[model samples]
Target: MKLYDHSVTVSSKRLNLFLKEIGVTDIERVEVNVREGGNLAQSYQDKSVNGKVPLLELDDGTYLSETVAISRYFDEITPNDLNLFGASTLERAKVEMWNRIVEIDGIQNAFQAFRNLSGIYADRENCVEAWGEEAKHRVELFLPKLDKQLGQSKYVATDNYTIADISAYIFVFVAVNALKVDVFETSQNIKRWFDDVSSRPALQN
Candidate 1:
């Protein structure tokens, strides 16, 4: 398998982190420099219709896009390996639920704010300052909710680590590292959770 990736973007980071956490290290990586318009090229667009990074190409010539789908595909192909999705039916539902919340309410808002405010994306798309401000505010609102969830559980979906935790961790990492927001400082529970997740050996890779 070949993973067409860009190291800097949030979605690419999430997929890379997921792969590491699941102990899948054999896949080859093809770097796509999105900032340089590598993803916008005809060659890349042919493989990924949406012109996005973190696309997974199977050995059988099947291409997969979308971070969530690629992560799930890894889980599906390696069912007997580490289970990042869930171990039980109910657990899978919970993981999916929390993953959706983190993606929609947390990561999406953060991305919107970054895309609109960052000069790096100025030529990539139309950015509205008002929309960026609104999106930043929404991210602030979502942090408290995530903190509350973390206070009740060690992990996002359950006691065990799952894809939901990976999703949330990447969002927080992007908020702090990319957006320059001190998200872990917003809540003690989140800070603790972040520290715990960060200590995982998989992330060191």
Candidate 2:
């Protein structure tokens, strides 16, 4: 398998972290310079029309996109003690639930907030400042609920460090550092949860 990687993107970070945790090192990696519009090129888009990086090409030339879906593929293939998805039926459902929360509420808002506010992607798409500001505001709204959830549960989705926590950990950096929505200061549970999960060895890479 081969992975087309935009090394600095959040999606790449998530998949890299997951692959590290699962200890899958055999896949070939081809770096795509997104800032230079490598991913936007027609040559690259032919493989995956979405034009997203961390695109995986399977052995038979099957193309796969989306960070979490690629991570799930690796998780299923890799048999290790580190089952990041979960261990059972209810657990998988819980993971999917919280992962979606992190993806949509946390990560997607951060993407909109950063891209629109910063106008980083203005060359490719329309950057609306009003939407960016609203997205930035929406970033903190997800935190209180996450904090409440963490207050009751040991982890974000479930007890184990599942994919939801991985998504949330990535979101925290965008929320606290990049977007400057530091409501984690007031929400003790999520702050504690972020600090705890952020300390994992795989994240260090």
Candidate 3:
């Protein structure tokens, strides 16, 4: 299997973290800088149609896009029933639920904040500068909700480190590190949970 990704992009971190979790030693990676326009780097330029990073290429040439999809694929690649995904249907559903919340509430807000404020992708599709302010508001709005959720749980779903944790943590980690959200100040439990996840050996790789 081969993974096509950007070296520094946050999305790539998700795939890399999962690969580390599963101890996938046989996979090869092609890291590149996909340009904003048509000028894409050599590694994924040919395979990428949307010009996105973290594209996974199966041995048969099937291309997989989206960070969450790719991370889940890698997490479940092994045949063992014991994995980050829940062991039962209800457990899996809960993980999925938290994953959805994280995607919408955490990741979306952070991306909106960056795209609107930093003007990073302003040259691309919708580039309204006003969205940045809205994104900041969205993120701030979700902090208290996150505090509520963390008030009763250590991990996001299944009461353990499941895909939900990975889904949420990857985005929140990026926000704290890149966006400087000061998550520690907003919620102490969130800070503690994040620190625990950050200390995992899979992330260090």
TM values, all candidates:
0.94, 0.96, 0.87
**What's model 1's TM-score?**
0.94
What 10-residue stretch in candidate 2 is worst by lDDT? Answer: 176-185
- Compose the digit string of candidate 1's lDDT tens values, residues 116-150: 87756676788998898898889888999999999
Q: How accurate is candidate 3 locally (lDDT)?
A: 0.74
Sort the candidates on TM-score, descending order: 2, 1, 3
Better of 2 and 3 by TM-score: 2
Candidate 3 deviant stretches above 4 angstroms: 35-46, 80-82
lDDT of 3 by residue, 1-205 (tens): 7787776777777767766677775778775655453225454557766668878888999888887788778766665544577778988888788888888988888877777777766556576677877876777777777767777888877567876777778777767776777778978878878888888887774
Task: Give model 3's clash tally.
Answer: 0
Residue 47 accuracy (lDDT) in model 2: 95
- lDDT scores of the candidates, listed in order: 0.87, 0.87, 0.74
| CA displacement after TM-score superposition, residue 37 of candidate 1 (Å) | 0.5
Best to worst by lDDT, what's the order?
2, 1, 3
